[model samples]
Target: MARVRVLMAKPGLDGHDRGVKVVARALRDAGMEVVYTGLHQTPEEIVEAAIQEDVDIVGLSILSGAHMTLIPRVNELLKENGASDIVVIGGGTIPEEDVLALKEGGWAKEIFTPGTPLENIVEWINSHVKSKDN
Candidate 1:
């Protein structure tokens, strides 16, 4: 089995990166190759990196309350670029309604709120990505 390729990005002016770094390290430790795009990335940059890297998943860590704007934009860009196979998920200070909106917009498969276990994330990616081949 091949290692999962994950692109972890922090979009917009949200300067908090500690959580994203932790998740990246955890993903790496779980045998996934993680591409961490540091702070202040635009939706275009994130989508371009995801395509160029050929990542299996794109993880957006947003704490700036712009989830409504950024996540959908990224989703649209990915779809337009023919990279819709890449699964997008997010975590951070997002309201439940916005999370639902994201899902409805096909922007995210899941949104992890605070206190979600890292192991759960790894398991989710493994199951979801593996099942895609079937």
Candidate 2:
């Protein structure tokens, strides 16, 4: 099977990237193809890149308290572009209460908060995300 292709993005005004860089490295180390879209990316840019990359998953890192806006917009843009098959997930300073809505709304399949084990994230992706080539 082809390796899972994942697009890792930092959306909105968040400037800190150390955590996302670590996650991207971990995902890559896990044998997945990881593409990181640097910092201050808009939702549209992220969606376009994910679709263009043919990624199985779009993993967004948000820390600007704008999860409500960023995640949904990305998901919506993906759908509008006929790439809704690409799963969207996120991580960062998002609050616990919002997790349910993000998942229920189908905007994000998962959301990892600060302190979540890196191994757990890797395991979750291995189990949940299917490679597009499959």
Candidate 3:
């Protein structure tokens, strides 16, 4: 078995990154290989990084209420680039009503709103992301 690789990124103009950093560190502590793409990445840049890094998961943190816009773009790009197998998860300030739609729309595999435990994120990734090396 191989370690799960996760690419954690903050896309668009969301400059508040403390939460993402916390999650990144948590994921790292949990024995996963984590790549943190610092603030203000475009969707294309994020998708490119995910592909180039050969990550098993792309974890996006956004607080700008742009999930409906950005998540789909990232998802679309991943599909268009033949990388749709990359699991997409997100967090931060997302509305409860949008969660189901985001999941059903195939943009976000999971969306963690405010107050979600770090343990939950780690466990979800552990269960969902298969090691590509397998």
Say which candidate scores most in lDDT.
3
Give the per-residue Cα lDDT of candidate 2 at 77: 92
Per-model TM-score, in order, reads: 0.94, 0.98, 0.98
Each candidate's clash count: 0, 0, 0
Q: By summed lDDT, which 10 consecutive residues of candidate 3 come out lowest?
A: 92-101
Q: Which stretches of candidate 1 lie over 4 Å from their true place?
A: 131-134
- Per-residue accuracy of model 1 over 22-93 as CA lDDT, tens digit each: 999999999888999999999999999999988989999999999899999999999999999999999998
Q: For model 2, how does the per-residue alpha-carbon lDDT over 12-105 read when each residue is reduced to its tens digit?
A: 9869898899999999999999999999999999988998888999899998899999999998899899999998899999888898889988
RMSD from true fold, candidate 3: 0.6
Candidate 2 yields a Cα-based lDDT of: 0.93
| Per-residue lDDT of 24 in model 1 | 94
Ranking by lDDT: 3, 2, 1
TM-score of 3: 0.98
